[model samples]
Target: MVDELGARFATAGHEIALVGGPVRDILLGRGSKDLDFATSARPEVVERLLAGWANHVWDIGKAFGTIGCRKGEWVLEITTYRSESYDPTSRKPEVSYGDSLEGDLSRRDFAMNAMAVLLPSHQFVDPYGGMEDVANRVIRTPGSPEDSFSDDPLRMMRAARFAAQLDFTPDPAVVAAMEAMADRITIVSAERVRDELIKLVISPQPRKGLDLLVATGLADHVLPELPALQLELDEHHRHKDVYEHSLTVLEQAIDLEPRLGVELPDFVTRFAALIHDIGKPKTRKFEDGGKVTFHHHDVVGAKLAKKRMKALRFSNEQIDQVGKLVELHLRFHGYGTGEWTDSAVRRYVRDAGDLLSRLHVLTRADSTTRNKRKAEALRSAYDDLEERIARLQEQEELDSIRPDLDGNQIME
Candidate 1:
């Protein structure tokens, strides 16, 4: 595909290069179906060239110098070499076509993504030392960190997302710039920030990216609840750190996904685990003997999670799923040593409904206690619960259970 497209463009006296993420992924030996290219040809010319060659073509981003097409199994986005600048208060960027691939690459978010492969000729271009940065496993902007982020403050979040996606560390200067300019993220639309956050949360190494966000104060604007997990230290009480425990739970939930039949990159489960205890800080109370308790934190957390997700413009389905998970994450604790009767088990299954499988994983992952005896006890109790649920499922068809009559039936 690359050779054919490049040959066609070259023959037409236009320049084309496989640019940005596709180029970066190629160097890292990662396979990607999405191909991004930069061309010296204008959008119209690019569209003209792609005619009939592409199985399908679209111009949703034509104004931004981007034309998308698909050929065979490859999804391609061919964009004219462009430079974009954002107004201080606007969420959108004003894009202008550039004349050179180097100039286009220079404006990218990271040096690692700034490399390109000049198509047809197959020449590798690394004017910004992107190859070295990729080899070193570090992230740096093509230009100054400040300039790169100012062009599109969402790039700040992208830095974190890439860190999570690639398992690469940002350079100190990048981190410092993020810390200095964290407030700039507020100007970017909530939808963009939320999308970046979802990518980070679903990545293989979410904790690394999340930690950077918290460390750099980016979370302060985008997700205040995450940093607020660091509740005021009560030296005397000395309970497990809620913030650290949440991260551990997220990792454990991800680890349990395959075993429990939840799909990989289950953002609902992962996000629920991360925010399940967000209400702890809000509900913290000291008893007479200095024992700390977060009474009704599950219920409180459910509301908080829904509210925050709503603000981020998440879909109604996503909001409801995560909210319900947060609310039920603590329900298993009541079944001490499998003491629940058949009725109790039925209610448990009924309450969980479609979320039962995920609930199982979330409840199991929530047991992050270091105490071997307690952890074993929780696991055994859950094992018993699952076994009972399975038996009941066989005997009673608990999965399809419902009220005998609906509201309309009752009315009739």
Candidate 2:
């Protein structure tokens, strides 16, 4: 498809190149379904050029000098070479068409993403040593990190996202810039920050990237609760590091998705695990014997998760799902020796509603216990709960648990 597009562009007297992440991905020996290109053609001409050739085209990105279209199974975006400027207070950039591909690439977020592949001739362009940065597995700005991030602070999150997605470390200069300019992230739209965070969370080994964010002080701007956990004390010191424990929970929750069920987005269980104990920081109390108590942290954490997610522009449905998981995460700990009555199991299942499987994963993941005997006992108890819930589900639709009789029957 790209080859055909390249041929068409060449015939039309427009020089084009595969630009940005796709070109970088190719250099890394990775194939991607999404392709992006830089072309000398204006948006109007590009739209006109693709008018009949493309299977379908959309002008959603027209204002940004982008033309997005899809043909068969191939999805592609072609943007007129752009040079964009931004105001300190505004999240949106002022876009202007650029005449040179090198100038366009230099304005991109990272050096690796600044490389391009000239079409037809297939010549690689690396005006800023992007290929070398790729070879060293490090992220650096084509220009100064300050300039790159100031152009768009959301690029800071992208830096972390790429680190997570590619397992590459940021250059020391970039890290210093990130730490110094962390507050600049506030100027970015919440939606953009949320999107990059979601990418980081869903990336393989997100912890690596998250750790970098925390270390570089970026998490303090986007996810204050995450960094706040590091300062709080856990009771009994069961988990000396709340931040690491939360990450472990996220990992475990991901692993248990198939076991719990995959009907929901994988992010459901993962998000639950990530924020289940977020309340601990707020509820930490010094007990009588130098002991710490996070009484009702689950409930508090649920509220915190909702507030934080809302601030980050999460949807109502996702907010509800994650908030409920945080709230109910501690309920299973109350079950001693599988002693909960059938009524309790019914309430548990009913309260969880469609999130029962999610609750199961969150509860299990919360147990980062070291004592083998205690861990085994907790597992056995949870297993028993599952068995009882299954039995009750067989006898009475536990999911829709209600009074034994309907209103009509009661009236009769």
Candidate 3:
């Protein structure tokens, strides 16, 4: 696809380069389906260039010098060299054409992403040591970190996001710049912030990105609920660090996502795991027995999750799913001895709704105890609960809820 575009543009005396993320990913031996280009040809010219080959073309991004088009089995976006400037009070940037590729590259968020490949010529463009940075596995801005961040503070979060996605560390200078410029993220808008955070959360190494967010003080601005989990001790001084536990649960939930089915996104399980204990910090109370209790944390956490997710521009569906998982997270604790009756199992299934299987994953992953014996016991109990539910389903299908197995049979 790129070869075809490059050949046509080259014949017209315009230099077209496959640019940005696609180029960077290719250098790392990762294939990309979505391709972008920086061409000397203007948007109108690019539109004409694509019209011959494109099955469909759209000019939605034409004002920003981008022309999106699709050819057989390929989606491509070609843009003229861009010199875009952001408005400080508003996150929207005013994008204009730049005469040179260097200007466009310099405006990009990170050096790794700033690299490009001159199509057809197969030439590599690394104006800011992007190749070296990729080799070192460190993220750095193409220009001064401060200047780069001041232009678009969202780059600060992107820096952290890429650090997680690529398992690379941000430069100390970039981290410091993020710390100094954290306030600018507020101007970028909630929806944009939510989008970046979603990318970070969905990355393979989300903990790395989350850690950077906390260390750089970026989480304080974007998601204060996260860092607020730290140092929240119970009355008896008996509690795992909620912050670390939450990260552990995030990892555990991700590991358990296969149970939810391979096709499902792990976002809800991950988000639910990350924020499941959020209410602990809010509901801490000292009891007369010299103990602390978060009596209604699950309930409180559901509300908090709803409020925060809404504030961050998450969809109502997403909020409801996460909040439901949070609210019902502790219900399994009441099912002692795996003695739940058939009616109880049916109620459990009814309460779980479409999230029944997911609730199982969340329930099991929520157990972060180091005691192998207790862990085994909890696993055994959950296995029985699942078996009971399955039995109920089969029986209901076989004889309208009056077939072969009972709670006692399941426990056995």
Candidate 4:
């Protein structure tokens, strides 16, 4: 089918190449059914060419010089050679079609994504040594890093995304550029930043990406709460380093996803884990003996998480779920000695509602204490709590537990 489509463009006297990330993926042996092709043909011409051939075609990206179509099971986005640049004060880019494939490739965010394969003949094109960078598992820009990031500050976030997705390291120069231009990310839309963040969080190595974001000061602007975790200081190293601890909790939560029956890329769970302790810095109290206490941090953190999620343009449902998780993350600590009554167990299930499983995962992951005995005791207590919940659930359907009377009945 690819060959057929390639032949169609070749016969029409247009130059087309499978380009950008798709080409990079092909080289990485992770061939994708979602193909991106750069063509000398304009959007309209590309639409006309795909009319009879594709099973369906859509103009979702037409304004951006891209024409989308699906042929059989394969989805393809055919785009004209185009360059997009952003005005320094503008949140959006002004797009202009380019005349050459190399020119279009030059505007891509990363060197690994700057390669292409000329269609019909299947010749490879790597004008900026992208193949070498990909082979070395290094992230770099096709041109000057400053110019590339200045053209689109979102690429700074994309660097973190790629780092997470591919587990690749950015070149020192690229890292420096990101550090220098970190504040420029504010010019990009919150929605775009949120999307990049979603990608990074769901990637297999989210910790690595998040570390880069913090190290480069990108987190300071994009997620101030994250870097704020660094302020959770302990002079003697007695306390768990809250910033690193939160990241460790995120890793542990990701590992628990499959066992806990969470869907992969569960944003709510991961975000909850990462932001669960954000309130500690705000609630810290120093005692006479230098002990730090964070009373009611769960409640404070939940409110802060909601505010941050709203700023990042998260959906209301996502905000609510993550906020609830953050608020409830500390509740399990109160279930000491497994002495709760059946009513208390029901209340626990009721408070958790549909998020009980995720709450369980978060509560467990939150135990980053260094003492093995304490860790084992916490795990054992949680195991006992789970058993009690299961037994109660079997006997009385704890998931559907409710008040014996409706609001109207109580009023009467």
Q: Would you list the C-alpha lDDT of every candidate in the order shown?
A: 0.90, 0.87, 0.87, 0.90
User: 1 or 3: which has the higher TM-score?
Assistant: 1
| Local accuracy of candidate 3 as per-residue lDDT tens digits, 1-412 | 7787889999998989988999888878888878888999998899888888889999857888888988888888888998888776776889888888888898899999999888788888899988888889999998899988888888988988898788988989999999998988888889888999998998899999999999989999888889989955655668668899899888888888888974755787889989998898899877787677787999999999999999999999989989999999998988876577778879889988988877888899987588999988888888888888888888878786564789899778
Candidate 2, 19-123: lDDT as tens digits:
988888988998876799999999998998888789999885888898999888888899999888788777588898998898899889898999988888888
The candidate 2 region of ten consecutive residues with least summed lDDT is: 231-240
Residue-wise C-alpha lDDT for candidate 4, range 170-288, written one tens digit per residue:
99999999999999999899999999999999889999899999999999999999989986456865566789889999999998887667567788899999999999989988887
- Order of candidate numbers by lDDT, starting with the best: 1, 4, 3, 2
Number of clashing pairs per prediction, in order: 0, 0, 0, 0
- So what's the TM-score on candidate 3? 0.94
TM per candidate = 0.94, 0.92, 0.94, 0.94
Off by over 4 Å in 1: 260-262, 398-412
